[model samples]
Structures are given as C-alpha cells and as structure tokens.
Target: MNLLDVRKRSLGVSFNTEGQADIYVWSPIAKKVALVLPDKNKTISLAKEDMGYWHTSTTDIKPGDLYKIVLDDDLERPDPASLAQPEGVHGPSQAIDVNTFKWTDSNWNNIPLEDYILYELHTGTFTPEGTFASMEQKLDYLKELGVNAIEIMPVAQFPGSRNWGYDGVLPFATQNSYGGAEGLQHLVDACHQKGIAVILDVVYNHMGPEGNYLNDFGPYFTDKYNTPWGPALNFDDAGCDGVRKYFTENLLMWFRDFHIDAVRMDAVHAIKDFSATHILREMKMCVNELMQQTGRTHYMIVELDLNDTRFINPLEEQGFGMDAQWVDEFHHALRVTAGGDRNGYYSDFTGLQHLAKAYTDAYVYDGQYSPHRDKIFGIKAENNPGKQFIVFSQNHDQVGNRMLGERTSQLSSFEMQKLMAGAVMVSPFLPMLFMGEEYSEPNPFLYFVSHTDPELAEAVRKGRKAEFAAFHAQGEAPDPMAEDTFNESKLQWELLNQDPHQTMFRYYQTLIRLRKELPALRQLNRKQVEVVPNEEQQTLVLHRWHDNDHVVCVMNFSKTAQQVSLPSYSDSLTKVLDSAAPEWKGPAASPDQADSTSAVTVQPESIIIYTNHA
Candidate 1:
C-alpha cells in the first residue's frame, strides 16, 4: 500500500501523461468484462488477467469521465474502486485524477500523539454550510482554541446525504454531500497549513446496508460471522487477500494521497479477523512503511470495547501495533459521578472512586466484574502508556445514541460540566472534545439519516427507538429520517460570543492553554500520576508531575459546597486556575490562596487547579 505498491497496481483508472488510462478489476465470477465509457460512448472488452483480474488500457478515458463495467455484456456496475461517486452510489462512477490537484502542504509535519488535543467533529454538522470548504474557514478558530488536531467523522460516501457516516459504502470516495474528494483535500491542506492535524474516522467493520455493490463484484462479505450492520467482511475467508488489499490501499490513500495525519478505525472489535497477521497489523506495517518513506508521523487509532493493550503494544512484543484506542471507561465513570443519566452500560460504573480508578488505570473494569454484561469484562492494558488511550467525557456515540441526544452540558449542572472538563483535560490519557463542547452549544446531536429506501428508513427509526428503550427517556426518540433532526444537530456558532456560553468557551480555552503551557501536565505516563478520592466527601484529587514540577486538580463531585483537604507534599500548592472564578461566570467561592498542607473550600460541583511552584 505504499507509493511503490500503488505504482505497480493497475486497479481503478490510473491516468498517465500520454492521455491513456489503465483500468483493472477483479471479478472471479464474471465470464465477460467490458469497460463502458459513457463519455466516449464506447465499450471495450477487457482481457482476462491472472487471479480473476480483468484489465484494459486505452486513451478514450479522461478525468471527470463517467464510466462503468459491463458484466457478460448485459449488466453494468460502477467501479468497485471508484475514486469519485459524486452522482450518488448507484450512479455512474466518475474518474478523478488525484495527482492533478496541487497541494500546498509539502512541508507539513504531523503532530505526535503525545501532544494531541483532539477536537472531534462531524463535517456535515460542524458548520452551517455543512461542507468541507465551510470547515476550512473555521481552522483559525480551532487554532485559537488550542486544539492541535481534529478527528473528523467518516467522510466516505454513504446513502443519500444525512448520516453519521458510519454506514459508508464507498471507501475511496469522499461524501459527495460534504464536497467530495477535492473538498476534503482542500480542507486537509488548510488544516495542515494552520498546524492542525487531521485524524479521519473510518468504518472498516461493515459496510452500510444500502448501495453496497461489493457483493456483486466479489466475495467482499462473508456469511461466516454476522455483524450488527450486516455480514462481516471477508478478511480471513476465501478471496480475502484482495479484500484486505482493497482496504489497506484505502488507508494509504488517506495518508499518502489525502495527507491525513491519522485514522480512527471505528468499532474494531466487530471486525472479526482471525488471520495469522490480523488486518490491523497489516495496516500498521503498511502505515509504518509510509511514515518511514515520507518522514511524517501517521497514527492508527482504533475504537474497541475490549481493553486489551495488544492493540497498542510494540510490534516486537507480538502485538497489533496500533497507535491508540478510545477509552470509554473514563467517560462512563465521569458521567455517573457527575449525576448524568445512568442506564445500560452506565449501570456498571458508580461513585467518585471509579473516576480515580480510570485515572490511575486506563480502564476501571480491567478484568473485573461487570453487572451490566453479567460477566467479567476487559483485560489489563499493561505495558501501554496512558497516551495510548483517548479519553473524553462525551463523544458522538454517547450523545447521538441517546433518545433525546442530550450532551453532557444538558445532562449536568454548569458546575458539574466544568468539573468534567477539568478532569478530562488534566487526566493522563489523551483528551478529545466533542464539537460545540467548548461553548456548550444548546443544540442536540440527533441521529439522522436520509435514505432513499422507505423500508430501510422505517427500520432504522424503529431500531433507534428500541436501542434507547432501556434508558427510559422522557419522550419518544426523534425520527432518524426527519430532515429536521439533521438540521437540529448543527452547532450554533454565534453562542460562543454570548454571556454564559462565552464564559464556558473561555474556561475551555484557559484549560487547554494551561495543559499546553505546563510541561508536567503534558506527560501521559500513569506512573507519574497519583489519584486520591474521598468517598465520604465525594472529592477527587488528581496529581500529575515530573521531578519537581507538579500540577494538582481537585474536583468536588458533590451537589453542595464542601471543604476538600489536601495531604502535605514536597512544596506549597498555589492556586493557578479555578473554575469557580468570577471571570469564568462561577459563584466566586474559591479560597484566596492555598498550601498543600491546608484545605480549600470549593463551591458546589466545581474544580480547582493548583500547582507546586518552587
């Protein structure tokens, strides 16, 4: 999946300098294959090649030309490796020349995972226009907010327009509704120019239920294992080499072609790969080679329910070699402590001690009893640095999957919200902020999808309601097929300039700045961090330091004012940042000053940060 491997392949339509193109496709079941060039109004029968691959070279094809492949001279299908599906999934495929577009980010070096301050956003709902170009305009604002990287939800082509992008069918093509491939490249270029790395969330577990034509081409799916979305992909089954190559090439395309700094593989636990070399390991080796050649740091983060460190451990240690994985244990514990709605998975987490456990260890349920699942869950994430886990109080799944799609800002009090923010930013693990979290945007992130098929749309609606039945929310879930639902998810950008919203925004800005300015706060080593929680007082003190430098974050999870004591340390602790300060629109109840040996009175459900200054 490197440039050399890409140059050797004839798959898709690769245009050359002589105005000629080489097209290659692998369809084992087909007896006849013909290149149908609608732009030239001609059809050329392709010659059969080795390994069920059909190939044809001709000068008739050009960039932006519409084409399809004819099977047995009767049925025509879009290219399985289509670069641009601007005219929807069922429409004719458009040939796009990726090399033609000039890139301005040749000198861009990607930010490492250790320094990552990720802001997760959905392209369609991030801005009012809901396009990549509109997202490009907001790069400066994100830069000012101190976010070093942006983790975008999938942009791969899905059915109709309004989706979470999880149901993407076309791996190569960017979502046409989000400005297609060129727009994505432009957005990536703009982000790189402003020192912001782009981490794309990709769905490799299963394709969407609609517009999935891979089965028509070959055995891209298998009946061996069933997935939540559909049949599992053919990773270790027959004809899996080609399927693995297809996905591996797609990963390289994002990194090499689109200049994406990283990729967050969605729901990796669902991808059942039993091969000797797992698909993730293959991807890791491929990405590592690309990094060595390009001298750019590219990360491969995965979303897995399993808290196994093998995913992020070193390859020499017989591991998968993934850069990092999403940690949901912290979010669940924080949600339960902050008085948020606890249902289903939230039932397993309780009390302020759970939060402390998540801080000391990456997961609270590491090989522990889980009442929710009625069994033991998760393995110890040993030998892995805390940076290998991405922690957040709220994400797309935690918010949009709810019946009301209420965010943490809506679920908890203003002081509780500040406390959660303090815990996430100062924690040892990497931090991710959901879109509009900085300003606490009032709008909800409803689950919306615009499917052309009515039957499928109705099924999705019913499924969503059934998923949230256990939460026992007040009213019925919003209709996923409603255009209003998608519209309601858009961020209210103007609120950042308003009264309380502006204060919340400043609070986040200050926290991010402090996280970056302090060297002791940047380390992700759990051994360097200490967490002490008082069950009776419901207060948690997170202390992270290196050598003589120390930063302590004291959080009161109680609903009323309380005096939280601190044990004496090597140096006196002075107040550095207080979430209850008058400037941050708090109750202005913070103590005047503090020493490590004394106690400080904290307002209801607030956070106070102190540092040991020599």
Candidate 2:
C-alpha cells in the first residue's frame, strides 16, 4: 500500500490499518520505544515486535501530527520516512501531503533523448547570487540559445558555503546556503513554467567525510567494499533492506517531491551491490513505479566509467535500464584535438583521425587494444543503442581537475577556441556545455569542497596534488584547499561584450538554433550517423541523416594553412555556418577548399557546417 495515500500524517508513525490511525517507531537498539507527541503531551509506549518494529494503534494520532522518536528517553530524531525537511536535516520531518502542491505541467512532456541539448552548470558558481532564482533569471537566455535542459550539479547539502556539490552529505535536503528547499522548488517551478527540463546530479555511493550521520543509526556502510569517498553502502549485507530504502526513497523524493524531471546518478560503479536485483536495476524499477504513480515520464542517467553498453541496453538483454550515459570517448577526443595534451587518457588519442572517428563513431577505442591501460577497452557499439548518449567538449571534471585548472580557451588560440564551440554544437550526440562555455567565460571550474575538519582538509589538499603529479611529470597545480580555488571557479559573466567571446557566443546560439530547427540534426533513435575521413589530410566530414535531408559537418584540425579538396556530390552544399568565415571573424584564411592542393586553403584551426541543397 502507498502510505502517502493515507489520510492522517504524523511524525514517528505509520498507519495501523487503511482507516485506522497508529503510531510506529522501530528502535532495535533502544531498551524501550516511546512515541511522544510534544504538541499534545501524549505519551504512548509501543509494543516492540520480534523484528524490532514498534507499533501501537492510537486514535489520537492524526494528519499533520508532530512527534519524534524517543531513543531510550534521551535523544529524539526525525522520522526516516520524512516527506519534507522544512527545518533542514537536523530538524523535524514535516508530514507533507504529496497531493498538496499544485503542479501546472499537466500536458507537458519532456523532449526525447536524441533531441536534448544540455547546459551543465553549478548553481552556486553560475551567478553572484548563487541560488536557484539566480539561474531562473537566465531561462530566457537558455531558451534563446536553444538549450532544452539544464543539468545542474548536485544541490544536496554538503558542508560550508561553496562546493562542487558532488560530495553531498544529506541526500534528501537542499543546500541551505544556496537558498534552501523552498528556493529549489521555486527554481523547478520556474524552469517548467518556461519550457526547460531540470536534471539533478546525485551521489549515491558515498557521502561526504563530515555531516554524514547515517552510520550513527545503523549499518548504512560496510567494509566488504570500499569507495574513494568514505564508505561503500551496505547494499548486500545483513539488515541492508533499509539501506536500499534510503536510496530509493531519495530518488523518489527528488522526482516526486522536488518536481525534478531527471537525475544524473554519480559514479554507479562505486556502489557495491551484490543483490539478485542490483541497486541500479532497483532504481530503474522504482523510477518506473514513480512514473506510473505520477503519470510523468522521468529519466535516470548514469555517469559510468566502465564503458559498458548494458546500461542503456534493454533489461531482457541483460542490461541495466539507464536512459543514457556520458560518453567520454567524444569528450577525450575533442579535448586532445583542441588542447593537445596526451598526459592521461589523451595518450590513447592523438591526431585528427581519432577526433574524426570519435565524432563519426562515439568510441575511438571500441573493443580496440589499449597501450594506456595494457588491456582491451570499450565494447563495439557498431550496432544501434536505443537510449540517448550525452557528450560535452569540456565539463567540470575535465577542466577543474587539471593541474592549473585551465579551460580550453585559456590554452588554445582564439581560432581554435571558436572551432571547438562549432564542433561541439554540430555533433550528432546530445551536446552539453559547462557553465560560461557559451560566452567563453574564463572561470577556472576548479574542484572545491568545504571540509571543516583540519585533517580531512589536509588530506584532500595533498591528495589532489599527488593525483596530478602521478599523471604528468611536472606542472603547476592549483591549491585544492585554498579560497582562491573557489574564487577562481566563479563565472566571469560580464564577458559577453568582449570581441571573440561575443562572436563565439553568437556562434553557439546559432548552432543551437540549427540543432532545434533542423530535422537531420535531431536525435532519432538509430545509428544513422556517419564520418568520412580525408586519409592524407587533417580533416573529417560528418553526416547526420533523416529521411531525405542531411546535415553535413567539416572540421579542420591543423596548425597551418592547407587546401582541402571538396567531394563531387549531386547535392549542392549551402554553407550554414563557417567558423573560419568573416562573420565570425575566424582567423582561418582558406580561399578555396575544392583545389587539388585539391585543397581548401584552411587556416590553422576551424570547423564548417553546411546545409545540403539537393
């Protein structure tokens, strides 16, 4: 039975029957369980069951009742099934009637996976105000730029004022410093009011080093498995049923209670689950049930490093039901092409060939031998994937985790920078941009966290430096624990008026318009994308096809000027956007591309998109 459908809602209680009221509090560790209604001064001792679930049928307990679980008559705490945390995590759990909030999106439907253009932004760093309402102010800008969804970094409560938001300690509560819970609701309502979907990033594997008090209650973590963060959840151990409920409840809380449309589960591989039905599978099942309950289609995305296709594959085919995953192949290839650093995974990717292959095929090392890992990596996804695949040129991890926390534009030439923007928008995969990427804001996007403990802070500081040193020989690394790290990570919003920044901004907006308007560029559930390489030159041609119409993309990846010979096709090519063109004022100077130098005299770096005229 759905407990939410019951009439009366009280703290530290559950229904005895469909129509009867009963107060319940299970204290396995407590010698005696007492349900104290502080409002009425009514005290009732529950008869503890063999399973330790304390229960009592009391007619006095009614809806909107306020009570707390008295643990051995010493400490009282919020209910584990708290629907609302009006007073934050350490306060009372309000009994919220699920059907109370008046939702306005009755006929609203989310855009298909293939049709998504995501803009990933951290709420705290996006604006000076650093709240949900602050980002809400930019809805018109996103709509104008053609971004359909805003993928926000984790908003769950961590420690202190500023953070990356990934190491969320309280899974159910919104960050108090970032305008708290009511403010977040306002943001979601505002986003839906405008035509945008909101995707939240959630970490289920491990909690922050501090403020994570789940262990104080029971065996929420286990030593059987370990994660980089503090402890792996006890998903397979004894008394693990409640652990599963904790995560599943958090998932439903986001979608149903917070009105969040989608969630990006952080690090699925880190979750240690040996259950018959895995945690990921259970999550998908719970989400499916929520969809049936709410009559809304919500999406669950996985951020996996395993590079397994079973995530998006069908359940009958022995796959986890993930809507999509972040494809690092495309991101790595594009980064190396633009930044030209082969320190880490970039070692596997070098020239324009890999970049071309990545844009053409989503994976560059698909089941291929790898020298970096000394093992074969990635599966051959030559066949079609039903779920959508998300890709971005530069994201928080790529830019922030760097040895100096440098952005692409900080290192690449202006010409190359604009080409990167052009390349990102025209690509077939679902494109996402980290905040300030559109206007080329020079924010560092560095990794920042607030740990009050001195020892933990020092460990994080030393760990970050050592991690980078392991990958590269020598480089100036940012101080992970310094105040400057957070200060530098904030977006410099006024850069919109700058010359090259404005030009690139317009280029991004134009490409977004094209992605939304063009049918060929839209994501259709199939593998209809193709990449044609110029074997001898640093150029690649890409094509995305619909029924009869086709969208063509050409990329120039050299440091010097060169001629690129055009292919002889029946359809005349209409240049839709040219990064090296004068309107964008690109530095490229390719006079003609069809010459035998069969050459298109291309500048140092550029990308060109043209419409096919049949």
Candidate 3:
C-alpha cells in the first residue's frame, strides 16, 4: 500500500516530506488503518505502531485534496481534522488549508472583560432567518443597544438543523444548519469589523449523549465518574494525553484559527482532571501564551457553580487563574429583589440582606454560612482584590429550568422589570444580558435540541420533564425539540416599537453608556464595595465607589411604592439613573440641587444612581 501524505502547520499533525506521513487518529477499534486519496492517486496507506499512529506517506496527496480512510476495511470514515465537511457528518471530509482564509482582523485587540456587557444569545433562535448572514445584519442594532460582546451558544455540528447546540457531537464540524464553519466565520468577521467581540460558549466537559463516536476512537471517556449527559472525559488515564490535547487544541483553534476573542467555558467545574497541574490552568497558560504571541488579549472565562474562588485566582495563589467567573450571588440577589421568591438554590438567598450582599460583595454567598449546601460555600469575592465578577438578573438556566420557562418579565410588572434592569446594569461587577431581555421580549428561551436518534430525542424530552418535576415549581416543561420552543424563543422584533419594551431598551442603553463613562463605576475592585442592607424596609443599597469621586447605587424591592430616608451622600452628587423616571432616564436624571447629600425619599420599585457632580 502506498503511503498518504499528512502535514499541518498546526500543533497536532505533521508530515514534512512526501511518502512519510505522520498520521494520527483517536480510533482504537480499528486493527488496520489506510488513508485513501481519490482520483486513483494511489493505494497509499499509513503504517501503524504505538496505538493508532498511522504513518508512512507519499507525494500522492496535495493541498485541496479530498480523502477518506478505510478503517481496517471495516468502516470508511472522513478525516477528523477536515477543514470542510461539505458532505455533512456522515459523508466525506474536504481538506482545505487554514492559512488561505484571509483574516481582516489583523489589528483586532480583544475587547477587555471590564468592557464586556455580554449578550448571551442562541444563534438558531436569534433571528427569523436563523443564519449567520441574517444575524450579521442585526449587529449594528446590537451595537446601538450597547452590547460590546456577543456570547454565542455552542455551534459545533449536532444531529439536525435545530438545537440549543449542547447536543453537539462533532466538535470540529460546525453545525450544518447554521451554514457550517463559513457562516460562523462571516459572523465573526462582521463582529470584528463592527468592533464587537465574540465569545463562544464551549462544552467540553461531556459530549452529547447521541451521535458521539469518540469511544470508537479510544478511551475518550471513562466510567470512573458519570456526567448527567454521559461519561466524564479520561483526563488522567494513561492514554488521555492525546485526548486532553485534542480538547485544548480545539479551544486554541477558536481563538487562533477562528479569531474568536474569548471562550465561555461551560461548567468548567464539571471538567475533572487530576494532572500534576490542572488542565484548565494549562489551557489558560496556553491561550494566554497565544495572546502574547498574537498581540491580542484572548481570554478564558469559566462558568463554575462550585463557588470556589480558586477558579479566578492566580495559579501561584492556588486559584484556577481564569480571567473571570460568573458571580451567581449577583443573579441570586437580583432575583430575590425582583421576584421575592426563594426556592431551589434561591433558598440560600431570601430577603434584602442577600440582595445587599450581592450589591456590595458581588457574591451573596461570599464567605457566608449557608444552610443550602450545609457547609460554608466560599470566601468573599472581595478577597480576590482586583477582578470583575459577571452578574446577570436572568440567564439561560434560571429561566429555562422552570416548568413553564417563564421569564422574569412574566413574573413582574413593567415598573418592577425596569427597576431590575437598573439594578443589573449599575452594579460594581460587570453586567450581562440574556438575548431579548433588554427589550423585555415576551418570549421564552427554552432548551431546544434536534436529535436524529428517536430514542435519544425521547430521553431529552422526558429528562426535561423529570428535572423540572424535581423542582416542583411549574408543570409542563417546554419540549426542547419542539418547533414551538424555537419559534417561541425568537425575539419579537416588533416589541422594540412597544412602549415599555422600547422604554426599557433605551433605559438599558443609557445605563451601559453611563457604566462606560463613569469613573467610579469602572473600578473592578471587588474589595471597594460597601453595602447598606435594610432588612425591615426590604431595601438594599450599595456604593460601587471611589471615595473622592463617588457613586451611589440604591435599589427598592417592594411591590408597592415606599418612601425611605437614607443617610447623606459622602460627596455632592446628582442622580444619574432612576430606573423609574418614565423611561431611559440614565444620565439624564438629576438629583435635586439642594444639597450634595441629604435624607431623600425613594419611590417604590425604583433604582437611583447618584454620581458626584463636584
């Protein structure tokens, strides 16, 4: 058999000379592997030794070549690293040179974390057209709405045209429904051109339960521990080096090859790796090194529920060294203030103190004793010193977990909703928004999947029911695979013209602009936060402050209007944002010019942002 040529400028595979291919695949089931080039080029096959290392190459294969492999003549498969999967998941792989895709973002410095008012959006549901090209048209509008970064849900190839994308099985292949990798590239290019950063939400902890063929390759996963989806990855096992590299390399690819500015590592705490050092740490160092080389500030952020501060601290200091972590405290506090209900994890956060803690400390549970977890959960985020925690009043999980998938908007009045938006944007920690939240789009962001396997599809539907039933909160979970779920999730573009929706959008935009312009609000110092908690009044106020140049953040959580007297301000200040001033009053509201500080009455369901005018 003639040997097929394999060479890459990438870190993974390389074959420098003809007839000497350095071929590597994860396939373990195959006893013999042969690389087959089309057009009767030759019967060149690679030699195999030391666990799936198929080598030996010839000049038969060249750039722009199409190829498939005879896996022990048992199964014919496509190249794992195929740059183009024109034939879909079950078809032949098209090899293309990565160097040829012209990048227009040579000068793109990543948007900083502090600057990111993240918009977490699901692509397939983001627009009626449901394509990246269609989505690109809306970039200007999002830009106008003050979205600096777009945190897109996962886009790797899954089974069908519709999915929330967590069901992705082919990590290398972009979902065909979204116009594949090219479509994503167009979106990235458009975002870069518009000075908007793109952060992909990647799931590497566990593969989707269906259409997963990694096990056919080798011990990609082990039964040592089980994830809700499937088996956990075998990161520490003997043959796990390549597996770890595969995942890490893919992450770097998102930054390097695709020009993605950042990655929102999904549920990183679920990523169990017990190497001498942590895999996450290694991944961070690797990406940071790449950023240094490219002169860009690509970041690795994580979504960890572990409440472990170590995830955000430096490696030497014994933390995970992530650029940032989502502070659930912010979400919890905001939820309690807006919704006034405590169940599930919300059980830990009840009343105004929790909301105040979230306002002051960024994490409501920071260093607090918790009855929910039984043991103490974490140290105050202030201990981290100089970092920004991401806060959101409503995110995908909180809304979708409901049996009815009702939005926070559904549970509150127009005034209350506006007030919640104010509390979210004006806080010390950096802020984020779920898509459709700013406009208060009256649509539900439910979990949706399109699995080809009927049995697998049924399981997803049933699992949704069971999970929500355990909560015992609401009945009738949205069928993620249903056409209605996808249809219902799309933003009602018409809502922008509605009074309350338009008002809220403008209000949100104002808060974001103020956040950018305010010197005091720009401070990422978690330690500098001060909370004045009022349990009896159900009022929580905090100062995300610079003493000499001060800013005051006040929140009112009651359903009805209540006037409260507060202590005088430290410095002469003007009211910068009143969430209840009809609409879009951020930066426009002025404190009564009588005194710099005084006992003032706050209306019910209002948030006041006072900025020093001195």
Q: How should the candidates be ordered by TM-score, best one leading? A: 1, 3, 2
Taking the tens digit of each residue's C-alpha lDDT, what string does model 2 give over 1-614? 12322123322344443534565543456677766777889876777765445677767666566665566777776655454455555555443344444677766677676777899989888887788888889899888777889999998877676788876666766777787667777888888888899899998888887656566546778988888876688899977766676677678777876788888988888988878888888778778877887787788887887767767775676677888888877778877776568876789887567877766666678788888888998876555452457788788888887777778878787778777777777776778888888877766788887677788788888888777776565564676667778878888877888877888788888878877777777655346667766646667777777776776677777776656555545565656667787778866434322311243455667876656632
lDDT of 2: 0.72
Off by over 4 Å in 1: 1-10, 469-473
Question: Candidates' lDDT values, in order?
Answer: 0.86, 0.72, 0.72
Tell me the deviation in Å of residue 144 in model 2.
Answer: 1.7
Q: The CA-based lDDT of model 3 is what?
A: 0.72
Q: Give the TM-score of candidate 2.
A: 0.87
lDDT of 1 by residue, 374-443 (tens): 9888787766887899999899999998788888878887878888999899998899999999988889
Of models 1 and 2, which has the larger TM-score? 1
What TM-score against the true fold does each predicted structure earn? Answer: 0.97, 0.87, 0.91
**Structural RMSD, model 3:** 3.9
Minimal lDDT window, size 10, model 1 = 1-10
TM-score of candidate 1 relative to the true fold: 0.97
Best by lDDT: 1
Name the TM-score of candidate 3: 0.91
Tens-digit lDDT string for candidate 3 (195-310): 99999989888887665666766678888777876689888776777677677778877777688888888888788887877888878877767776777778787888876777
The candidate that achieves the highest TM-score relative to the unseen native structure: 1
